[model samples]
Target chain A: MTSTTAPVDASTTNRTVRLASRPTGEPSAENFRIADEPLPTPGDGEVLLRTIYLSLDPYMRGRMSDAESYAAPVPVDGVMEGGTVCEVVESRSEALEPGDIVLAYGGWQTYVVAPANQVRRLDPTRAPISTAVGVLGMPGFTAYAGLLEIGKPQAGETVVVAAASGPVGSAVGQIAMVKGARAVGIAGGPEKCAHVKDELGFDAVIDHRDPEFKAKLKEATPDGIDVYFENVGGKVFDAVLPRMNTYGRIPLCGLVSQYNLTRLPDGPNRVPSVMQRILTKSLTVRGFIQNEFVKAHYKQFQADMAQWIADGAVRYREDVVEGLDNAPEAFLGMLRGTNFGKLVIQVGADPTQSA
Target chain B: MTSTTAPVDASTTNRTVRLASRPTGEPSAENFRIADEPLPTPGDGEVLLRTIYLSLDPYMRGRMSDAESYAAPVPVDGVMEGGTVCEVVESRSEALEPGDIVLAYGGWQTYVVAPANQVRRLDPTRAPISTAVGVLGMPGFTAYAGLLEIGKPQAGETVVVAAASGPVGSAVGQIAMVKGARAVGIAGGPEKCAHVKDELGFDAVIDHRDPEFKAKLKEATPDGIDVYFENVGGKVFDAVLPRMNTYGRIPLCGLVSQYNLTRLPDGPNRVPSVMQRILTKSLTVRGFIQNEFVKAHYKQFQADMAQWIADGAVRYREDVVEGLDNAPEAFLGMLRGTNFGKLVIQVGADPTQSA
Candidate 1:
């Protein structure tokens, strides 16, 4: 894998998705636009890459809005940010060469140029290169860091997670099981619930959309919940709070259910119940981003996750939406809980398959 | 103060306050009634005590209701439970002698008997004997354990506490100051707020009842709140939540404002905001009771608190009600923020002052 036909010269050809306007609620196709720009050139200590797989996650909805958040939102007319598995097309740094596969923050573009030090080189022989954008990438790291650092699940403890079929929630349940805790997953509809329990090997699964959701959740957690890895907040959270055990820990990763919520649920406020449950049960509810723990936990996460995949102790599924033109629709579907698993866009043909 | 004279016998008579009925909400005088019982006799391993000071705290409100809580509710016709500064009237064990001041769970009674080992003898020279039930006692330990152990207020961080004129809140603000953090107190009125800032030496004070409470809180916390010692969670908590900085810590200890609420605050549940704020700001909201830290941090609390009071680094105020008969009314007032500081019923004359 040396210099491949002079790098295809992306300097005159680039397709990108830029934010047209912020959404009032759930994002629509009108909020994004397809644009073309002269491809950027690699500067000193940098590499130009062509994206092969673009990952779409629930958090991207947050980046599309100008809300006060842990990270800044994408400015109007700017490229929508995303994680990508890319092949180095042009290299100016000693650390890398053309044809190398690596992970990059390439946004929703077909090509990008970034500092060589910022991307991690990937080995295709060890695992699928596309996983660098899914289970084995940012989403996996999100579950790993949040559960271990904040959730601290112990043996025999009941750990419940909503959005259980998604990348983060699936890993959370499996990792909890590896730690000897009972894993209970909550997903929408029976199909997703069945997949979570039978395929993911969770101890139990409950359908959040069921009319008897609260009763089913109570039945699933006989000893009450000791850890709730919160990815979906709203009705799911309201039901889980009363069921938490004394000294329970809630590692809140994302509130996907409320991401597009324009208004809160109508009723008598539940703040008193939250405060009471916290005090009476001595529960810990901590919200965190994966980057905060990367320095301390990333190395361990990669090693453990790789071995888990190799040994069949852990498994993953990818919902690969085809073409760069379909990314906006796929991203919107992922937020509405339509994606079956880790959602990613097949941006370009994989050159590694020919090797 | 040793066994200088014979113990006064109360074997033939006793005066006590017993729960007449559980209140629907905000316990009234009718819910409590005066009663007489034959003074309890010390058994082989128990000691007889004469109640000198009865400490009334917000937790008693929880015990007076039938609602499930961390601890059991007071049964009808049972003497209301409380922490009391007492004198050993009769000793059956060698650990304590008559005339020694001690801290005991003596309830609302003139005379009672407890296991000798359950009561700890108090040295008058350590501080005032009354303080054994006030600043140097349970309330002090609550503040010390919750702030240092859970809140973990760092130097230059802004720490805020509500009910700032009370024993727990005052100690919380002062201890935060001692830890090199900026302290802000929130009380009910100008008088209590003034005492919290001017007398207790808090860096700033805000009255939660002010019409511009949210604005005032924002002004007081320029860097945003890093640690919130939550004791009176309701409107104060609502106003403070949005102002919290990223990675903020909330040690939820009590909710005095909601203790008397027959119903929750009206409409459009604010739970969504709580979840969203928690996720976006990467906050840590932990609920706890002082007893949880007793095994790990109790010994250190006694040493540090004594040294603090000795060096004039900590000071306390006592809103001493004159008689045991007035306890129910004073307790009710305290819940409404009418009582200023550590409310205690002076059940009997101080035995140490006579010495």
Candidate 2:
């Protein structure tokens, strides 16, 4: 394989979704703008990538707002930020060649030009190419590192995670199972709950939409929760907190339930009560971004996760929304817990997957 | 010295302070009752301890209530629980002899018969015997383990602690300084603020009672707080949360401010926002009791603290009340931040002190 750059053709163009405006509470379609522009040329040490699949996540809702976060928010009229699986169309670097599939932060766009070193090459023979943006990518690593490092689920301990049908939470539960911990999942609907319990192989699954959500959570975790992979905050947190055992751990990665919240809820400011619980229970509540562990754990995560997938110890589902045009609606649906699995936008046709 | 048992005299009586009633909010004189009981004799492998100094701490306030906590609540009409420095009046084991000073959980009584192995003997030649209940014992060890193990103060980083003039906070600041970190202290009044800054040698000290406390805290931690030894919670926590640096750690030891609260305060529950801050800043908030680190870090703590005290890098002050009869009053004062330093009742004469 050799690096090659194709001549810029006037017929080729890039379609992109940009942030039109910031949302107040829940985002509407008016917050996004679809535009078409001429394809970018590959520079020295860079590769021109055509996006195959764009991931839609709850964290993107956070990136839409200008609130203080671990990552910078997408600016108005800028390409909405996200992870994507792309194919190298034109390369000017020795590290990557034309037709090579790679995982890149090409965001909500049909095409991108990135440094070859910045994008990681994905071998299509090992797994589906789309899994690069789902199970074998950032979301999977988020669950892997946060659960193992902060949550530290010991054998026979109960590990609970909400959004069990989604990428991060699904992986959290399954990986906890792999480590000999009893994985209890909390999902919003009966179908998702069943999938999480039957297919994902979690020890227990509770439907968060049930009126007895708290009681169900309590029932599911009879021995009490030792590790809670906190992805969805709000009432789920309220339910899980009291069920936490002594010396329990909370690996806080995302709070999707509160991401759309315009303001804090009315109450007696229960932060102190939470602090009181943390003190009396000897709990550890740690917030982390998965990237913090990449330098140390990414290689190990890839190897262990690959093995788990091979042995059928781990399973993942993808809710693929067709076309770049459907991304905005799909993303909104994901925030509302409508998406069933690792939600991704099939931006363009995949060459590796046989039709 | 040899193990010996004193003859129990029929005329000798033990004076005790028992929990008459549980306090709803602030404990009062009515909550405690002073009584006389017959002296207990030492059994085989047991020793009789005559309370010389009774330590008054904020945690005792929690034990007074029937609320669920890390430790069980004191039973109604039971002896008020506390740590005490005692003189072994009779020993039936080879570990201790008569007149040997030891640290014991003797409660609010003048004398207690405990298993000889349970009490820890203190060397008066190394430090003051009263220190067994203060700087050289539990309080100091709490500061050492919580700060070093959990807080993990790094060189040139800023470390903040509240109740700076009190036993735990004072040692926390000094140890942070010993670790080459900048120490910021928060205390209630001018006297304590002065002592924390001038005498205890904190890098900076703030008067928490000041109307501009939040502003002062921000001003004190110019580079932002890398480690916060959370000894006081409530408004102090609210102020410190915004000032925490990314990847900061909080060793949650005590919530002195909320110990007496009968009910939670009103309006706009901020637990989510606190979680949001934790997420954005990648913060670690862990709660712990000092005894958790006893097996792993206590020996190192003793060696390191002894050297620091010897090298003049650490200093402590004790506010001794004249009699056990004054303990309830002194304890009430300590809760209100009226009593400075480590509050203790001199139950009997300290023969080791050359007075």
Candidate 3:
């Protein structure tokens, strides 16, 4: 272990959680290892950051596998990648200054050095810095692009989203409401369902864990679903399939339920039935990654999202854990739908606050 | 059977094929029965017609099953529904005159009566009367709408269509080529594949039956496929899936291979794998019924297709059966991939043609 007496500078040491092994099912603590190493120095046009809040999302499960994916897999012995809100501790560029709070992709580390252009400076007075790692960042942008671009929710139509209390789903429901569409939310329990309906103002919210979940969903949207922003594909999707209206659009954003599966579930293959409905209904089922629309929609998204957040047209919730060591367990819980809101790890206190 | 001799006037008799039973796998001749009955006089604003050509399409297979579909199932003893080209023998409305050839949904019959406004008049001088039942009608419209509206072929891109020798598939390839996109066609055998490439002018063609079919597809498309007009889904779809480029668009018009499936195939469900690729590659798979775009694009389609036919920019072939007795067998053969080109039953010869 490094001595605490060492000066806290770019050459000083830091600790990080590394990918110890690839996960086959629900990841275990054994899949990650914590290691301490010397901090990297800021080169020209670079800055050193001290992590404040790290965002944990479902997409991370994809990064742990060696399978071919939109993005490259995290290598063994490397820090697990993620979005973070950090403070610049040292700057070698004219664009940034030390102690500035900014949004970064510094991953599961206490400190990181990255090119200055890669980080965006966050205004502490405008909104909480932690939000830049959640609602004002990737999750919010994902909901905006997937819904408006693909879902194309027209006025008076019903739009349904699953995992409804999470950052993405909650934002999707609120945005649909803003667009003058009916929003129906599906969550795992009564509490989350209540949060979606009473707090987030969804037109209807159903607990998917209930035995009568399918029936509830059917009754909730009597006019049938026009846009299903698919985030969880399992029983939730199976129920929604039959109720899709003609010309229905499904913007498939994620499939969290099947992510940790070691092998395909035993089945009577449902592909034919799915295809049959698609043909008869003239449905449009499109899958998308948020980054694909960034060049065209990102600037608009940032401006609109910031306004929506400021005006309370869009609301977000966060479940913050205090220490880096707890991320592995919190992430596992998140995959199992145990998290109540967006899960974030507060790696350390904001450096601007006096100890 | 009723007596064949009857007055060839307002009280003339009509003969029709009816659905006797639902089919199991391939429809058998026993599942259909022909009936002869007296035809009543035309009502006010209705016209009487003599059937010249009746179209036989794959969609008829769905009508033979009791299972629910986009449209209602054919009643147990009703005339098998179909599009036909007919000559007006009598008229009670200003829209028609005797000897006029028109497009009508007159079903499988020798003579029938319908409101004059329900049919579109066809000029025999502009093209063969039988073309109204094939290339210049529903099948051709299906191809035009599905490709241009949903597939959105761009110049210099590669467009792949399965069932390439079939009516819809052939048109899709031709139109893609006309729009400056490279067309790669997939058909069942060497003869059909040759016809697709040589006769239709597809840039490249491959036989799906070849053991090296997938490898051949990769070799033919050095640039990955940008548009996939999906009409035949099965092993053919499996082969084309991995070859799809980023942001590829698939306009799924049909899935002929899975229509007769009695039960789901044994699993290691491939659905998850399919969804994963959709997210990672950002591919768009949309299912459509062509009629959705008809109100906006139909007039343009008819004008453009007629010009293409006249200049040889588009060519069409038909497999016509001599009599209605062979219609059931021909249709069954078509569903099994044994018939080549558009399948039409020649119910009767044109009275205007001198023999």
lDDT of every model, 2 decimals: 0.90, 0.91, 0.88
Interface RMSD of 3: 1.2
TM-scores of all predicted structures:
0.96, 0.97, 0.95
Give me the runs in candidate 1 sitting further than 4 Å from their true place. Answer: A1-12, B1-11
Query: Is candidate 1 or 2 superior in DockQ?
Result: 1
Q: Write the per-residue lDDT of candidate 3 for residues A26-46, one digit (tens) a residue.
A: 888888887778888999999
Write candidate 2's Cα lDDT for A213-239 as tens digits: 888888889999999999999899988
Error of 2 at B88 (Å): 1.2
**DockQ, model 2, C-alpha based:** 0.79
Pick the winner on TM-score between candidates 1 and 2. Answer: 2
TM-score for candidate 3: 0.95
Looking at chain B only, the TM-scores across the models are 0.95, 0.96, 0.95
**Clashing residue pairs in candidate 1 (N, C-alpha, C atoms within 3 angstroms):** none
Q: Please give the lDDT score at residue B143 for candidate 1.
A: 92
Per-prediction DockQ, in order?
A: 0.79, 0.79, 0.71
Which candidate gets the maximum TM-score versus the true structure? 2
- Candidate 3: how large is its RMSD? 2.8
